[model samples]
Target: MAETDREIKDSLVRAGRPDRVEGRHVNMPVELGSTMVFDTLAAFEAARAERYRSGTLYYNRYGNAASFKLETALATLEGASAVTLTSSGVAAITLTLMALTAPGTHLLVADNVYGNTRAFCDGVLAGQNVEVEYFDPMIGGRISALFRPNTAAIMFEAPGSGTFEVCDAPAIAEACRAHGVTSVFDGTWATPVFCRPLSLGVDVLVYSASKYISGHSDCMLGVVACSDADLAMRIRKHVMAVGDKTGGQEVMLVLRGLRTLDVRMKAIDAAGRRIADWFAGQPQVKRLLHPAFESCPGHEFWKRDYSGAAGLFGVIFHPCADDDVRAFVDALRHFGIGVSWGGYESLVLPVRPVRTAQRWDEPGPLIRFNIGLEDTQSLIDDLDAALPLMNTGLEA
Candidate 1:
């Protein structure tokens, strides 16, 4: 009998299940150890020889059973031939770029990528003699104009970080394919539940598992998924060589979090869209930077390429005094001020969009919000109470 396709939630729940276990434990046991003992010398030699070739598990640094289980689950989720777990999301990005690029390699990066990503490219990759050119996220199919004969790759983010400008990923990826250049995408925002970059012709898909995959704010982890087996091998080899490995317990947390990712993502999406729509109706909001809205740049591409939205979005306040902006955010009781999001608690952060290849002309401050599992009406009431702070110009 042919197996039928299951829904994402069902697949996630069933993923990484051991075929047979003695104790019948629902989750994979956390195997924590740096060394693996072998009975015979020949077995040790064979494992060492196959380390880079077959991804043999010889040492914990290379990865343990728990890490492999999580990697397998993530690979399945992202529709990738293989996946590599890393210490952090930034490490995933760095490792993928380092594996694919060489000195003098030319990279075309989206201008609106995460600030840390830009810093790494400009500071580290630049020192390595890698040439990086930032391009407008809305360039779409026209990005071919920026490609050079020596262009090695293109890095992009859908519904870009902070600003929420959706890029034309498929069109840009098609151009990269035609030119024989590698395509890398930051899939942290949408995750595989909402968008699959591999299906869109992207060769490498990177994620900050610490945000959505871990669900809780406790763990810090990242995973890089590759569609090509050879590319995956290269990434794995590089990760092993660089000693960039994730702990066994962190992998277990991410694996556990995967089971509930679908439900959490959907719930947060509904709440975020409701708040964004409500914000649009407010006169104090200059603009709503959400991919689902037509006002956002390249939103049509988002609607066409993405199956769903995440909880993160940005809002531009009407031109006002800095004190008013500060008062509004300071007055919020439900939304905690924080740097990262995707946890159980809602968070809000003030952001200054920094762009060189593009222009940001908003006259007011911008705030990025991460709607959590809180009740929708309760969050709305919190915002309602805070909004008066801006209207009254009160520091209270």
Candidate 2:
């Protein structure tokens, strides 16, 4: 179709388009649009049916070319039939749970999921009269024993949030399939570069792209990957109804991140192992909660399923006064003190595990470290310097 006189005059200016070009852009152009104008009534009707879920040019709320391109990249990564982009990481998880469940729905969630996830289950899901049960993250094939007749979905996120306990996801996924239950997984800690949850038989894979995928901590994004077309469509419709949308700029940020995901993950994996090993050898460190280390719970399963480990890990310092532990963290020079991780700068966070299925009986201070694109030796030096501060009061 030829450009209309209006397009030739002001449409290019309205689009913020570059000078008229005959060649293609190396990057996916960020086409900002909301109101889509169809040339004719026939074209409009055809679009409402044929192009609705296909991510073609339609209304912006459903999805646009920019968001769909990013979704396609993620779907390709995780071996999923479809991917839905969301506003934030938590939104992706919450939306999936809401879409697949209802009042009286029996939902099984891993006890070690992110605190935000647990809050949603405890507050929103429970308020709606949904039956929410928390199971051990390492329950594995035994998870089937907890499933009820009305069990609608089971959610799991591994390299467990604050505790760093990896889940035997394949076993749980297999059980979900046998019982005809939806399995939702969050592998944000280990993006598709290190792990692909869908191929492990999980029904839906939810991930936060804000961390490792964005690589620079500038974008807030989330994704849901589903291989079953019907299941994908159901979730997509729910997302549309709720008016959840991923902005074109945010999707573009993720697209930029993907160009280097594999190489970046490789570097992060090496640096993480180095730091975890250093922590393991420290006399003040009682336990290393790293997936690649044998001391970490579910390390065997991680080795079996994952191609690499995320740079994030947990450490428990041997009995030290709470003040001394705070002093130790305060004395760190290279690592930033923050809650979120998986960016270019290293971060250290004091974290405590909250569990109901299992008791956290360890008598020590727990801290999480996210080793970023930093010099391993410098990180080790910083850790080494901070270790003595933890023992300042104990040694006396």
Candidate 3:
């Protein structure tokens, strides 16, 4: 059977793990340290030369057995040529952007990208003299018209940050290939479970593992999975140069999370869809921002490209008083008002995406929800109670 035909869920448990040895345990042991001593002078020199190579355990920053294993497993799952683990999601985005573009090069970014990552383009990349340009997330293949001679890479997030807008990725990838520009994608929302960006013709797929891959919301990690060996090597060299490292303990945690990702992702997918549909029928909700819904921009592309939807999505509410919005948020008993999502616990936050390329003249008071593994009715009931609060101010 073809690799695609094989059960990916089974691979989640077995990939990157060695076959069981009679005397050894099933899971690989996590190793922690900075330095490794070699017995022979020749061996030490050889190991030092090969330190930058994957799984070469000469130094802690380079990576250990666990790090290599996680990288291998993630690469296999994503159908990527190689993988690079970084200290944080910000590092992964910055490093890829830094490595791809230089002082004179140009970058095309989606206006609705993660605000934190978008700031780097304005700040650090600006300091480095790289020209950064933001474009409408709905531009689709028309993005080709904006490419300049100095254009190096285009980084975008599908089902974008804060406001969920799915860009036309296959079209964008085609444009990149024609223009000889690199395409970097933030595939955190879909991951490898719901969607694989590499298979969609994207060059690099970066993810924030702190959210779902770590599963428990305890690990702070970023991952880069690339299709091109040369490009992957360039990013890896930059990672080494920056002395960025992901601890073995975090790798173990991520691996543990990966074991159940198939089940959790699907469950969350189902729950989020049900809730997103529920929000659409509410009197206060002006529009649903879910990519799977027909009302969402580029929903057609999402249908054509992605295998399924992720738990993260947004809901736009009709004009509401500030006090009422607060009452609605405060009224929720189960949903946590938090920054990040993709944990076992559900999260809710009011979102106002600052867009430069396009006007975000949607309905007032957009609320984003990250559905968790909670009981469907309980969450719906929690929202059902809160929906009334959007009209009535918080009781004094």
Candidate 4:
């Protein structure tokens, strides 16, 4: 049995050794092989039979020693009993959903979840008769009222995309536990370094290892960590059933990234806060939607739960024309226009708030910014030059 969350976390923090691998000193090496050879017929049979149980590894698709090592590291960090890796973040989430719910089960998700996630719920899960109801990201404790008899789980994103509304995760988790429903939080933003969702009562924690974990944006991977052994088994079964396995190269990349995650995260936190402060003072920026900012929704919850904020955050542009955004993008020198973030370089992207039946009046156009390791002065300079280029902001 695992010890307390603190003890588990300490073990995880100490397990990351980028320079050492398989008793070798190579910094990085691909554990590429679809098959694993057994010592004898009985060993092969035993491996085959033990495939369904924990502590046994058969093939790469099921899980290899390297994969399990990475999983253990993640589980240790998140204070989880076990973890499952997938080819992509979407696969991790999809497998988790399938493992946790049946065809008739219902799910409550934040309206502001990732676009692809919403698509999965509406297009795939809904088609299979799994009812998904969208809830306000700021619903907080009131989320309990939305629970139905068939509700199986609640999926939430902290500081949800486009609009940076941080949800009260503890309140939501408490409500879920009271009703015998499981809760999953997309911990891609905080990772284990910043926030420990399992410690905060979250049943399952998921992450896009492709982002901060990989750090280089060259590989794609996902991690699903769970505290319950039974739930972990279900997740693993679903992962294997769906053929959702990450490549050894990606796993190695994530391992390499883990070695430097602490240093990178600290740099990101400092630069991100400085950028958020800069945006707060900008005339063209109407609202700085970073959790560190006082005006951010659920700021108190974030301050209480999160050890630090990462690079990603949003800023609402003062009411301006679309052409102004075009000019601003063209003027930017350092910030690249892209979708994925958490890399060494900075990125910016225009995002339209996903409007639902509940549409609150937003102030202006929104742009999500992922501040990188670049010098604060240089990033500020780039933004300063781009602000006046907004054609729509010329007069009105």
Candidate number with greatest lDDT = 3
Q: What is the C-alpha RMSD of each candidate to the true structure, in Å?
A: 2.5, 7.5, 2.4, 2.7
Give the total clashing residue pairs for model 1: 0
Where is model 4 poorest over a 10-residue stretch in terms of lDDT?
1-10
- Encode model 2's per-residue lDDT on 1-396: one tens digit a residue: 003333222321222222346785645677688899999998888788855485677798888777777776677667788888889889999999999999999999999999999999999999998999999888899999999999999989988998988888989999999999999999899887677788888999998899998888888898988989899888888877789888888877777777667678889999999999988877788889999999999999899988889999999888878888789889988899987778889999888889887788988899999999988899999988878989733332
Q: Which residues of candidate 4, in runs, are more than 4 Å off? A: 1-13, 16-23, 26-28, 52-55, 391-396
> On residues 150-202, what C-alpha lDDT tens digit does candidate 1 reach at each position?
89988888778999998888899898888889989998998777888888888
lDDT of 3 by residue, 316-364 (tens): 8878788888999999998999998889999999998888888888658
Ten contiguous residues with the weakest lDDT in model 2 = 8-17
Model 3: CA > 4 A from native: 1-6, 392-396
Which candidate model has the greater lDDT, 1 or 4?
1
What is candidate 4's TM-score against the reference? 0.93
What TM-score do all the candidates reach, one by one?
A: 0.95, 0.92, 0.96, 0.93
Ranking the candidates on lDDT from highest down gives 3, 1, 2, 4
Residues 1-396, candidate 4: write the lDDT tens digits: 224544544554456444454677433467777888888999999999878554477886787767777877787677788888889888888889878878999999899888778889888899989998999888988998999999999888887876778888999999999999999988898777788888888898887998887888898998898888898888888888878778888888898888778778889999899989977877777788898888888889889998889899988777877887888887899999898888889999989877573685875778888888889899999998788776435333
Deviation (Å) of 278 in candidate 1: 1.3
**Global Cα lDDT for candidate 4:** 0.82
Candidate 2 ranges beyond 4 A from true positions: 1-22, 50-52, 392-396
